[model samples]
Target: MSNSLEILQKYWNHDAFRTPQEEIIASVLAAKDTFGLMPTGGGKSITFQVPAMMMEGICLVISPLVALMKDQVENLQNKGIKAICLTGGISSDEIIDLLDNCEFGNYKFLYLSPERLQNDWILERIKNLPINLIAIDEAHCVSQWGNDFRPAYLKIVKLKEYFPKVPFLALTASATKRVQEDIVKLLQLDNPAVFTKSFARENLAYMVFNVEDKLHLMEQILKKNPQPSIIYVNNRKSCSETVTQLESLGFSATYYHGGLSPKDKENHMKLWMNEKVQTIVATNAFGMGIDKANVKTVIHLHIPPNLENYYQEAGRAGRNGEKAFAVLLTNPSDVIHVEAQFLSVLSDKAFLNLVYIKICNYFRIAYGEGIDEKFSFNINHFCTKYSLPILKVYNALQFLDRQGIINLSQEFTEKITLQFIIPSKEVIRYMSLNKQDEEVILTILRTSPGIYESQSVINISLIAKKSNTDENKVLAILHKLNEKGVIELHAKNNDATLTFNEVREDERTINRVAKYLEAQNKLKTDQLKSVLHYIKEEKKCKNKLLLSYFGEVINEDCGVCSYCISKNKTKTDTSTLSEKIIGLLKIQDLNSRDVVKLTKYSKDDVIFVLKNLLENDTIMVKPNNLYSLKN
Candidate 1:
């Protein structure tokens, strides 16, 4: 068998391993359970991939993210390694065939979600495979104390019953001491060799600012950095609005969110990655599995839900070890806003049970039935019909999904099916009369043939593109045609796809996962409180605060952070600050805010110097409150 370094060189084309990766790989190869706590962008995949390449049999890799699993499997396949990922939407026959390939076709890696292990048939098939290593990615999900806890991850430990001697490798980028201990105990990792890389990012400067005008501050930051960067917002509307705002200010930018189509997401990411765009304005959905090394800055328009999320998102910058910045812009009201957004929407056990029963009833599923049944779900319509709060219901659905009761797919598309009632010649006459709708009608007719004979699904976006119009216009034209009896249009606004992963047991099904839901809600509340504290904190070093939260203690403060810089500014002599303010006033009359901006000093110091100057007549305040130098 090839050694780990030889395998890494042969496949990854890397000359040597990064720090701690070689050690983790050695432990895994020694047939011992291993746990690796590395920071984001720390090359965690190398430790498992290199050793798995040298192993004798196939490696069973369990991950919580379907997109991550697919991406990793594709990447390995591109490197001429045999790999397969089993996610939702695949048929049983397809799964059996894939497993057969893993067993007999010399496949090296079988990446699957933790929820898949709950399937008895899949588990039985997996038991027959010659597994070499059981690798768990995002292992923190197994811990209730972690920021993102998924109860389905607990099922991953059942694999140990089948492969008792097979070594397990659990890896995560963000996990505290409590979370690490939970991962070890819950995953049944037997006396695992743990490797932790310090969470301190030496080259990254953490900054927090309370600003009145966040957009203006963001623009100033972008101008100062002017390199590849990511601006994270909390919602889809903000992503698009921020991009438009940045573009109007003469900057190149694009937006990313879960609502965007896959093609659009990929295209936007490519534009940012290839330097065709200077920045990517995105929601939190944009950054998993992304490896861009030259990001000079990462700015958050609003505070994140937790420090773990903030650290991971901020750590995306300066991966190449050069100087970079992580900035958070917030105001006093943001505390209440964040709580309303994240905390208020948390669903309790009773709410989850209600949602579960209502959904099953809506779908007309009988009790103890409805396994593997899928439906197109419109959350707005469902909530309206049941008279429930949209945010709370959405949260409940997400919780059910995490518990493996249902597979919620938020990538939804509008389904439009239409059939023309009028003859082709009469349709021409109608279009001639309604000239404004002529192009959309013609485009739809040309793109969707046989519309007069039978109903057919049409792509509204495609029709809009072909006619050089927008989707809204096309939809309006279709509705007008339908109203005129020219066509029979059926349109359903589907924003998600729901698949029942388990039988409908109503309250019993919910009761089984009630403890987890309660714990998760409590965890979320605690995390939000921590986030608020971090934002309000002023005395501690920003980097040290973040590191300490992650269970790492460091003596020295990161001198580049906002707190350190402010602390240094307070040490400057008052006379020196007054001299700088006088020099600025001599150039031109300026206000206190502008003086602070120009001098790069703390606001209090600038204000203090301005007060002294005004009292001593060194500088005089004009009518408009602008300070001017005395002649």
Candidate 2:
């Protein structure tokens, strides 16, 4: 066998692999199927990358996220490994050509989405390729028990049938015992070697604070930690609002959500990643594939629906093994509010059916038509046209996606492009005539490469910087230029595209998927209850509670968490209580029982304090057992 260490050093510049990475790589290299259950930052990618480089043929990776596939492909190519990812919007001819190159060319890695595997042509072509190993990232998605399960993952089993000799490496960051067993069974691995690193992060402290004002609590936490952090909210409006609120408190903050354009998202991400900003207030779409290692804290402004979601998002902190905190700031009402919002939409059968019909109409698909057709959809437009609630519509769309009736993906495209319509002399002549237009035109020309030759993608923020203005100004100038026939500009758009995976059969199709949707709703409710239970649990060790939820056992309490801190504070203050009782008696006499009831101390502690006070002549008990200070 080829040396994996040499391959790793030559490509990645890493001298050693983290625990179980080397072990997992060795198992795959020895022609054994393996399952790696590592934490969020556990170096799972290198397990396949290093082994695939040392082996002979191509490594086929089936992933679900287009962004993740794109990032990993670019990273591998930068390391001098030939890699390609086949995703949506690519033509059939382009995919065929790419696969043909992979078959003949010495390509080390082929990353493609799971939906791509369902394509008959792609599957047939893949059968002819020289495949050595198969890696399934996010393997838990194959099981219905997982939070992010996708039906497309079920198609992965077909690869094993085609190449019986090839070994499969299934990996997920977080999965329970049930999900792990399901992954092994669903992938049909033959006695695979399993590697499960515990989900416990000893460096991370988990805390939950019930407060009246969540924002106030958040500000306090940020003030103390005051490092690179992520504040996760549930909606786009909340994301922006939180950022605004934080900035009003004199903290450098930015915001991100799925609704932002590609350029805007990139700009905000760079600001946070480069440490130009202290905190990034974002929706759930913020953290995948983001590699900032020094995130000191991750605070959730609202409760997540499941432990898996919380674990993954909170786990983003302290990746560099420093002491960090994951705190959830919520109130009693938040639990009821979140549950009501989700269940109202998710559990409504009639509402979901209406949404399904409306979606078909929105896409102009008649009954029993539009199978496997993709359409660019705007949720706002659909909701406004039908007068439906936006959140409910979104939930229904998600239900369709989980049911395999449709594939909905949000595409944040770099659509900022410009093609000059007027000649260079006219532009200069017009610029000389109009002083207001001169700066914007010059900024565009300087920032965009090949703007004169053809349409080019431009960054609005970079143009703003060069023009000494803002993004709104840059965009306004672009729009004015387009109107004046000086340029044809296409502004950036952040919209979701929906593809009909099956024909629009109306009620029959909805009924077919109704059972699965019902089960999903039940699971979600149970998941929410479990998180609520964790938040309300007081006496249990926070770390031990979380570990036990993920099917692990730990004996000791995490000493630094809020629960332990409070517990310890009460343990070492027996003398302080006596002094407080004597001082209170000096102000006014009170019985021992009344003192215990009125004060926050326990009855036994108050009684102990009264006994010590009487022994030291600090207080005296009258005939009626009323304690009085000595004269």
Best by the lDDT measure:
1
Please give, for residues 1-631, the per-residue lDDT of candidate 2 as tens digits.
5598888888888898888899999899899999999978888899999999888899999888787898899999898789999977677789888998899999999999888887788899999989999999999899888777777898899988899999999999888888899999999999999998988888898988764457766887899998899999987657766877888888899989876777788999999999999999998888878878899999998888899889989999999899999998875457547777767666467788899898998879988799779888767556756778877788888877756688888653444778898889998998999898688789887766567766666756556666777768778878888999999888756568888878888889888767667667777888888888888787787888888877898888889776786677655377787777877887888865567666789754675566567678878756544688999
Q: Report lDDT (Cα) of residue 600, candidate 1.
A: 94
User: Best by TM-score, which number?
Assistant: 1
Root-mean-square deviation of Cα positions for candidate 1 versus the true structure, in angstroms: 9.4
Displacement of the residue 110 alpha carbon in candidate 1, Å: 0.4
Give each model's whole-structure lDDT: 0.87, 0.83
What TM-score fits each model? 0.82, 0.78
Where model 1 places Cα greater than 4 Å from the true spot, the runs are: 412-495, 571-631
- Give the 10-residue window scoring lowest on summed lDDT in candidate 2: 603-612
The alpha-carbon deviation from the true structure for residue 202 of candidate 1, after best TM-score superposition, in angstroms, is 0.2
